[model samples]
Target: MRSPKDFFAPLALGAPEPLREVPFRPSRMIHFFDPSNERMRAKVPDIAPTVDVLLGNLEDAVSADSKDAARAGLIEVGKAWEPGHTQLWTRVNSLDSPWFLDDVWALCHEIGDKLDVIMVPKVEGPEDIHYVDRLLAQLEARVGLERPLLVHAILETARGVANVESICLASPRMQGLSLGPADLAADRRMKTTRVGGGHPGYLVRTDPVPDGDDDARTSFQQDLWHYTLARMVDACGTAGILPYYGPFGDIADPIGCEDQFRNAYLLGCVGAWSLHPSQIAIAKRVFSPEPAEVAWAQRVVTEMGDGTGAVMIDGKMQDDATVKQCRVVLQLARDLSAADPELAAAYGLETA
Candidate 1:
């Protein structure tokens, strides 16, 4: 069995060196909505209060002809948005795209103070982050901004996945990494046509039973994202940056989406993306620890006192290793409480 030190070593590496001295806030769900969409844009103000993070998407879903419109729309939306506990973020066009340069230039110059994070898509390596880092630094300096705007890389390309570590460590402004499944699947030439979930055809079957025995039943529905998500969790965990599961395209199938997000959450992901309004609650529900789990963790900490040595809880063993898990929940509760008092109360936690 591994020691407590070995299990907790990942936390040290996974956490980025504290920069800007900003208070650690719980970004449980980074909600994505198209800024160019009139319906979505109209909903932003109300949406801002409900979600932890609200992102204005200017890429992928936006039309070629509407690139300029999307840019303007994001700026207008950013200018008008009153930053409450909800952080303001924007997903710019990919670095390789023609619109990206203008996207960065416009957002930085127009609403640098308002924006919290600039989500850079298809980040293949550290070089992509370096370029943006330098440009953002220059922009921040020009705007006379106090704190530098953070960057969140989208792990979508095959090259990006291959170079995730370098990208995560490329800049102090690198806040987190988000797994972009659809683009990654396309980039990797994956067989599955569906976005971000298990595929029934992509699985292994049991071998035929030996002589005279009945045919054995087999497993069904393989997790197509297992390899990628595991690698992503390892990469982010090792780097001290946050790991998030990307969007579930089938908004109608909340069950499958919840399953995917829950898998990521259990694998140590901090959060997941919610593309539609319906997905917001699912992501929030899955990402946070259960009440029973939280209460149990609290009991362990309360009983352990100094947090050293073995103890029995409900006839199960818990030691220093369990304290770390308890701390994880307590820390999340503390962070969430700091971010939103109402949510803290909803979870029955006292606001700090």
Candidate 2:
């Protein structure tokens, strides 16, 4: 391991100054809105403060004819970003797309200062990040932009998931990882038709059913993306960045959406994608630990001073491992309290 003093040295010559040692600002929900859509574009000012990150999407949901329009829309929306309450970000088209160059020029050249991070989709490995890193630096230099733009990689392909560690380490501008379950499932040839949720057929069932009584069988469902999310979280945490669970398409089922986001939150993901206005509250609620949970975590920490040895809290065992878990909850709560008054209130924290 490198010494503490050497930890923040620049990762590459032209890469953004290292933000590795800085604490990740809270982004509990990176709300996705198509910049090309008029209704969505209109919602930016209203929703910007409500979300931790406002992503003006320029890929996938955007049609070919709207590519230029999307770029223009992003510029308009980015320039109006609310600094602390919500960050302004834009998802550029894939690297191979014809419009990718134009998208970069519009956002990074025009309103780069207002933009926080640039989300790159279909990231297969570090090489992709390296290309964007170099290009972004060149553009920043060319445009005389003061601050370096950060990068957030979308792990949508199987290859991206496999190479997440390298991608996160590829640049100092790296912000976090977001799991794109739709494309990931397609790439992996998964049998699920729904976007980012458990399939009915994909579950665990009691074996044999008590002497072959098949009619009495009981089944237990599982989150199909658990493995990928876990891998992403471990990699992001290792790199000292953030990890988020991307979109849940079953918007009508708030329960399932909450459950999915909650599971990801418990498993170390810092936030998730909110595709609709309705889903934003769910993501926020699930990502922030409940007041009851915060209380218990605080109790454990108070009992385990110096963060060693063991203690008992409410008849449950609290040891080194448990203390570590409590620390995670408390730290997130404390950091989230800095900007989010609602979240601070939810976690029983005082806010000014």
Candidate 3:
């Protein structure tokens, strides 16, 4: 095992020098659909066209009896799916579960070439990632796979959140980390019964009125996930991997879900999970930068010309740092445009 000094040395070098060049396809929103659900499974072909990432979920929501079926369904889907811009991913059972071994063994041997990422659940530390990494490498070597499959960890436990930075850097094959709020709340012993959104019970109480008016307002409720989200953003940013907001279980409250996702997006999360079909459009809309913001970024790039020095924009100072920010948006726009032509047009990009 590598020492702590080695574990942190790469981050100390900084952001891996911006990848030399960006990938052609945009990874805006990773839409999560349960392959075990007949309705969702039936919609996969139709859904794949609209989303940037199509993930077949096998953990959490799938019933125990249906685990085998989900595995079979995913294998069939992976085999039948032709290469496309939309990347294919699957969330496997957790390492502790009876099903996880089979999930990995079958997937690695059967559809390893077709799969892009294997989402590992409840990852608590670097050890968890190391296990998956070694296993995946072994599997790839056995199958004579040309490219290594990537791994994504779900940061849900308190220990997982605390160890996120190390986990992100545990392996070169680590792709990203996602917030799993439901399991996190349970793991942390949080009192709220709600999944991943603001709860009145979890809020601060208002002060009592001097005149004894019970209806008087006091302190307002703040986001419960503020610290976790910020910490996750910093960890992911530091490690050069992407961070994502997990699913908001209250599918009926699309507005609240959007607000939660927007908070994560503003805080530097690259994408979010969409549990229901209704949640997909909300995620796609929230995670992508607004056209006004994108247009302004484009203007800044155009104004800078050479992208080396500072200048004034709307009487405000713009510099190399600001231009770098603009490039972030431009890269995202270009990637999204490549992935979905309709979405590209909606964002005012010229679609082919």
| Number of the predicted model whose lDDT against the real structure is largest | 2
Judged by lDDT against the true structure, how good is candidate 2? 0.85
How does candidate 3 score on lDDT? 0.82
Q: Which candidate is the best by TM-score?
A: 2
Tens-digit per-residue lDDT, 65-131, candidate 2: 9988888888887776657767888889999899889889878778988988999999999999878
lDDT of 3 at 73: 87
Off by over 4 Å in 3: 3-25, 204-214, 346-352
TM-score of 2: 0.93
Candidate 1 lDDT over 1-352, as tens digits, reads: 2253342221122232226432456677899887777777888878888888899889998999988988998898989978677889999999878999899889988988899989999999999987887677666666666667888899999999899888887766778888898999999998777878888888776676658444455766778888888898888777677888888889889999999999998898888888888998998788877767677778999988899999998898889999999989877766766766666776678886
Off by over 4 Å in 2: 1-16, 209-211
The residue-by-residue lDDT of candidate 3 on 1-352, one tens digit each, is 6774454233222222112212335556788877776777788789888777899888888899999989988888888887788889999999999999899889988998999889999999999998887677677777667676778899999999889888987876777888888899999999877889887755676777788877667767789888998898898777777888887989889999999999998898888888777887888888777888888999999999998888999998998999999899877877677666776776788865
Estimate the TM-score of every prediction: 0.90, 0.93, 0.88
Model 1 error, position 198 (Å)? 1.0
* Cα lDDT, all candidates: 0.81, 0.85, 0.82
lDDT score of residue 27 within candidate 1: 73
